[model samples]
Target: MSTAGQEEPDLRSIYHASGPWTGQTLYVAAHLGLADLLDDDPRGIGDIAKATASDEDALYRFCRALTALGMLAEHPGRSFTLRQAGRALRRDAADGFRDGVLLQSGAVFRAWADVLHTVRTGRPAFDHALGMDYFEFLAANPEEARVFNRAMGATMPAAIAALEHYAFGTCATVVDVGGGDGRLLASVLSRHPGMHGVLQDLPGTVSQAGENLSGVADRCTLVGESFFDAVATGGDVYILSRVLHDWDDDNAGRILRRVREAMPAHGRLILVESVLRPADGDLRSVLGDLLMLVVLGGRERTESEWAELLESAGFTMRQVWDDPGLATTRGHSVIEAVARAEADRPDTAHSSPPKAA
Candidate 1:
């Protein structure tokens, strides 16, 4: 009855010890495609092994591990079905994150192995592991590239919802800085008929936006150039959706500065990112932050962190919005920052709003 006072102790140590076991077991199931196989039918361990082409004994061990982890139910019949927590891996579902999760567990896992090196060197694990940066690695590995890009783009629905809910009452021409494949930009452009768009990104990335932006082509102009080298000018709203997180603060600042240069004093920058929060019933945000650490050498930033970044780039945060209920594996937070126009400021001669289309 007095166990609490006996050691006052090992709870923290126990939890910390269990962290790797939880993640590794999930990775094991993902790697073996066990859940995907079971999605079709409840299978015996032998059958699962046959279908996945895995060794039977190893498969049994894997299944036993999953069953112990509460990801599967094992009965006297020696057959297995997914537990409620594991059924999300089924491949046929419209929003199934199987591919994304598999891609991470398989490919990104290697990059993550170099996390210690990254910490020591202050460089991306991806760069150190592959001998090239992420975008460069993507350029060379077409298949893996698509998987990675899809995983990135898949977060758009929640992001789009947050954007639509935020007040964009005054924006007309909106420029999507580093908008890959134009999905997020297209969503915003579609929502506001009065708004035209400039989808600015790398030439290769912009080329892929053609098919994606077809429906919104009439209102979107695609501009291909390094955001560092050139950014298209003139827009009331400039967006950097999921862009700032890919680089360190210095480069992120450079991008914001470029957008600030192109934008008038009153222009607004809509920063769409997964805002990192402390563990407050939002585990997705925490997981995503760790993902950034292992995969990109980037960290998921807090609102205050974002504010500091924005301020350094000559912009100020005016509003921040989130739709956690709708977020994917990565929670969505839409931060709206404004580049104050002379008219809106205290010191300069007030100027009229930019011309609308």
Candidate 2:
């Protein structure tokens, strides 16, 4: 049944071999500031190497590889310019993914190399490779933590779109549990001028968040603590954006319970996360799920799974706003829930959930 002159698919080339090289190449480009250097105009390899203080011969080969990868456009006399894909590596581009590229190809790349270990042991490869959990590792490594925070901020716009999908009119005080760098909290306060915000995160993150939330600093209260202990009370709305997906169900439930305990009877819980699709074709969510698995032993959940998780933590799923047009590119959706009746609260005295590792 084979057609004459048609070649069979090379599964190994397509699936197995190309990813490492592509990821590493992108890391090199981002790490060297090559895209930012060429952002204004084309430059010769020698000029770029000089600007970056890199080996000219090695950088020349790197530029040639980028040209072949369609990220750079090669020209006469060995000058090179950025392609559309390469332009996204610029730090100043509004839609730039430079930080994300650095993160994924740097620490995340190292974690993925041990994916086989994760698959075999049901443990995070990052924990095994680094001798500490993801958050712990970030806490200890200041530079990598900066890269991680910036990477998180790089996708904040996509996650911010969820704010438009829900109504914050009834909310006067919003609490963002585990809100990193206060980007989400700042965005929320900017939109709802009358509303105030409480941003809770680890101490190190709270320090950085102070700068990020400076625009709305007067209206925001920063809490330097973990959500597993307690959150600021008296908030009309509590937000957990892209937080739950970083922990297992048990720890996630504990976080939700803490929020519930802090919330008033009528307060609402808003979860902004990537809800898994019924089918498997959503590239962002599928990849995000794997990233969580390999790095944190967490997961993206289905609608039913979310509902069940919420119910376990003394909340009832009120509505799920899945606006594909909003943040679909980043695979995010908004789910709104309410605290259940006092009698329905989990019996915390009888059971203890382990803190996130």
Candidate 3:
């Protein structure tokens, strides 16, 4: 089956992978607002450098590299225009990955550089790298926390779309547990005008959420508390969006138990997360699982694993709705579960006690 006049592909070239370099380059551009500047028109490297306060020749080389990568198109002179891929880096673009890029290329990138430590010790690399847990690190550095919050908010659309497909049936009050800045809860409140909402997070995040959710202030209650301690009870629906993935099974189960204790018998729990596939070919979810391991000592779950988790927390799995379109980017799915009957509730006598942060 040999092809005529065709030589064998060079396997050696594959060893010289450039993904990290490309990512770092894109991160530099994103951090410097390079794509944002070129959004309207092409600009010469000198002007771009002036705007970004970078060395002209260095900036020129960067632009040339970006052009080679198809992110920018080089003009006859030393000018460059944004290509289609580059447009996605624009800060103003609705579907922009700018904030996500910045976050990944910053702290996360540094933490991941030492991910082998996590692999060896079964602990988070972030703690090893920064001498503190991820959340604590974020708390100490407010600016980085702001960027992280924005990165989380950017993925809200996927959660919103998943919510649209599910029936929030008879849910008068919806509570978003661990909702940062109230973006997801706000979207839910806006979509269902009749539904009142509760946005719960840390004190700082809840305060910031107040501003983002001001329009629905009359209907939404902002709670600054730990879900590990308690959540506002009596909500017909409770949402844990991208929350459980930040903790190991023990802590995740503890958080779920708190929600269960607060939830009425008729209440439901909606877990918005990337459910891992049994076949293990899903690159996004796999990456996310690894990220959880490296950054938070957590991991993504499979459908069966989710079911088991829910059962242990006194909830019965009802349905799992996934948005296939968002699977590649956000890998979002809404796993709907309801409280088990009083007689069927699991015994929690041996469950680990909650730890104080």
Candidate 4:
């Protein structure tokens, strides 16, 4: 499979050095908004440079690099056009990942520099590199926290995919625990007009949720609280979308227990998280697991691991619905669960309608 001068596809391109190098290049392009500049039409290097306040020649070479990577097309007269792959880098594309580029390439990228510390000590590298916990740093630096919030909110595509095959069933009210900025909840409420929703997160974070919930404002409530303490009660369903994986079993169990304590006899709890597999050959998820290790001291779990965690907190797994068309990162199964006692009990006469707490 060797080409004329390609040297079996070139070791440099597949090597560790090339991975981060490519990432940094994309990071820089995103930082400069190069794709956005060329979004509507082709642009010459000089124009893009002037718009981004970057050096012309340097910008040309950078655009050429992205062109080589198939993200952009270098047209005649030193102009470049954003290619199909490049459109995904746009700020407002449906599958836009621009915020992801900025967030991952910013503080998180720096935190990854100390990944060896996480490996050796089973601790988060973010603490080693930034001298504070990831959440704490976000709280102290409001701007970075906003970036983190947007980046998390950008997972709307994944969230939609995860819920595509799932339904709310009899759940009239849904509570989104650790719901950042209410994007998921708003979307969910929009889909189920009869359903009321509650968005719960840190006080600072929940305050921002109001903006995204304007359309569903009348039917939604925002609660600024920690899951470790309590969750809004009386909801027929509780959602932990991309939430539990942020912690180890100890903390995850605690949070589940809180949700369990709040659930009524007929309530359901849904967990949207990657259930790690041994033979999936999915490197993105593997790297994501590592990212969790280095940045948040969290790890992806297998189906059995999820079952174990749920059962430990007095919940029994009822069903696991997955969207085969979606990726594992965002398309994780809707792990449907109910209180173990609720299922084990012989009588079911105590069911009650969902009520706002």
Candidate 5:
């Protein structure tokens, strides 16, 4: 009984304290626009409660908890002040995490709720929870699609990180496979004045991409099509950023081989993806790895696994540029690769490709 420091922390207590309860409280506050409401001036609980139509006593207690969490500051006469952390939740904050939070609470929440299904069957739970493919669901729901796009745009640090970490080596044309909203490609084109880019994704995504690429539109070609079916051809380099980890290896192989087929003899591949450590990986990488499993039935791979995948797809990995500062970005490295000579590819690699996208 006296082994206080040796006693393990109570898992259930930790779960109640930090898991669903805390997460949902913050989500509800964000959904209710509490941050924006408090942005102009601190307000009494009565006024805030009236604005949100929440019970006065209940809202006061909620704000109190938020104050304790450092998202708000409790003030005299039951008033509350928004804290710096709370300011980030404002709808218009450029670097806000609001969209990602809302997404995690909405469709992602629904899908992750069935993660047991994913773990048991070794398949994504998203399809079962949403009654369709994840991308298809996004296509049908415009509002949600916008949120997903914005949420993903936050991860475009990978684009900047890629450019700094790897040299394009005087490439002429760059094709972005599964590029979302064209933000990443736009960044690339802006960096290389002479380079042209091809942005390919679902038809809906391509439409959104056009507007985002206005600055570089003259140098960018927006193509709307599924990467699994075909990729646009005749580029010096192909970029697969935040794409591969969305599906199982078989489907990923299909995408890679499609790129291989489209690739010219001297083409290069730039994979902006996380390179996981076989053991002792960081929490962000591993949590994202789990997110892939629950939502897409994909996986984050170690460097060796990445090399193996590339080799099997008729390409060979050249170098993996690990950027320590990019730990928080979409992917930690830009994996450079080149098309393997057809004669050098494994005989088994040319067999029937994956039917799934």
Candidate 6:
């Protein structure tokens, strides 16, 4: 269809041509270890080929494309070096994002192809497309599992920073409900020497927690149980980090109620998640929202949505903290909600003494 003397371009045709252009380049870079090879200085194509054992012609083509994409820079004759865009490629760098990129490119890239199906059905496309749910799929698949852990690990620092500034105040114990491998718990206990932590998760997950928490073993008690089935009772603070986003509203409310039941009269519930803005203006939050829809059958929530969920679960939303640029490093920021403990329970506080006796 031609319009206004300009031929209408075929949308699908353009997509088809550019579809795998960048992805193929990333795959080539991953295979060649080009970033690691150029970690020192610029190198000619022949040296890079000999080091990675790649064909000279293919290596030259890959490097040229990467250079065009600004991921590499050409020096003198046939020599290339890492550009600013390629800094994340080095594995040993302090702020290296190589593992993060590799993980996204590996499993997530494959799963994201079914976005349309997930959108149509509002079910997890990972399960439908891969024939298994995410955790189950990762359990038996070690490479994918390692990638998942590394990807999660990449966000721990920001999460830790958020927890560091949060007001714990007079709380003696914290139970990390649905804590994955106890990373956040360990980080908290390391910061607060007086506080003790009870780390709870599924039996299969606890074994991994045992390995990850070896350094802080003395400060944490690891429990093996599903959050849906059981949780440790009576902690002053119940921390749910990155847990609620994996569930829908009803299920999320149930999880919050379970935590409330296990809390004391004056206890607090801390929910740490990336709070989604209600509107579509924020591209990052919007993309995260879509990701939740496609992969987890959940959605990134607005502050109001989170407040509603918590209130329905018998907790009042006390406050929400700003995550600042800390969240920008990763895709989302940390939002903490304080849940009131004695709202639903009537008999917790003893009646006041008769006129001060």
C-alpha local distance difference test of each model: 0.75, 0.83, 0.83, 0.81, 0.82, 0.74
Regions of candidate 6 where Cα sits further than 4 Å from its true position: 1-20, 53-55, 209-215, 278-280, 325-341, 344-357
Quote the lDDT for 184 in model 3. Answer: 81
For candidate 2, list the clashing residue pairs, or say none.
none
Which regions of candidate 5 fall more than 4 Å away from where they truly are?
Answer: 1-17, 326-331, 342-357
Give the per-residue lDDT of model 4 (tens digit) for 1-357: 454676465576577445776888888787888777886477888888888988888888888889888889988899998888988788777777888888888889998788889889999999999999888998899878777777887776687567654667656899999988888888888888899998999897888777789999999988999999999998998999999888978889999999998888888888888777756655667778888889999888878889999999999887776654546336465788888988666663222322221
**Model 1 spans > 4 angstroms off:** 1-21, 75-77, 277-287, 323-330, 340-357
Position 118, candidate 4: lDDT = 89
TM-score computed on alpha carbons, candidate 6? 0.81
Tens digits of per-residue lDDT for model 5 on 1-357? 334577667989867777866777788787778998995466999999899989999888888888877899988899998999988778888778877878777788888788899989988899889898787888899888888888888768756555553467668999999998888888888879999999999887788777779899999888899999999998988999888988788999999999999998878888888888636537678888998988888999889999999999998887776655544444557787888784354431221211221
What's the C-alpha lDDT at position 220 in model 4? 92
Q: Per-candidate TM vs. native?
A: 0.81, 0.88, 0.88, 0.88, 0.87, 0.81
How much is 348 displaced in model 5, in angstroms?
Answer: 24
325 Cα displacement, candidate 5 (Å): 3.8
lDDT of 3 by residue, 101-188 (tens): 8888888888888989998999999999989999999889988888898888888888777676566767899999999888788888
C-alpha positional error of residue 354 in candidate 6 after TM-score superposition, expressed in Å: 38
- Global lDDT of model 4: 0.81
Q: Against the true structure, what is every candidate's RMSD?
A: 5.4, 6.7, 6.8, 5.3, 6.4, 7.3
Better of 2 and 6 by TM-score: 2
Residue-level lDDT tens digits of model 6 in 1-357: 345787778889867545666766776786467888884477999999999998998899989998987789988889999987787777665656677667666666666887788878878887887888777878879887876777677667666666666667677798998887788898888768898899998777677887667777887888898888767996888888778888889888888888877777677777778787635347667777777777777787888888889889888776676544454324343443444655446643222111210
Estimate, for each residue in 1-357, the C-alpha lDDT of model 1 and write its tens digit: 234446554777867646655566677776676777774356787787788888888778778888887788886656788877787665554555656776776667778778888778877787788788777777888887877777666666656665665556677788999888898888887778888999999887899998888878999999999999878998887888888887788888898899889987767778878787775545666767667766776777889999999889887777676655553424667787777444246643222321222
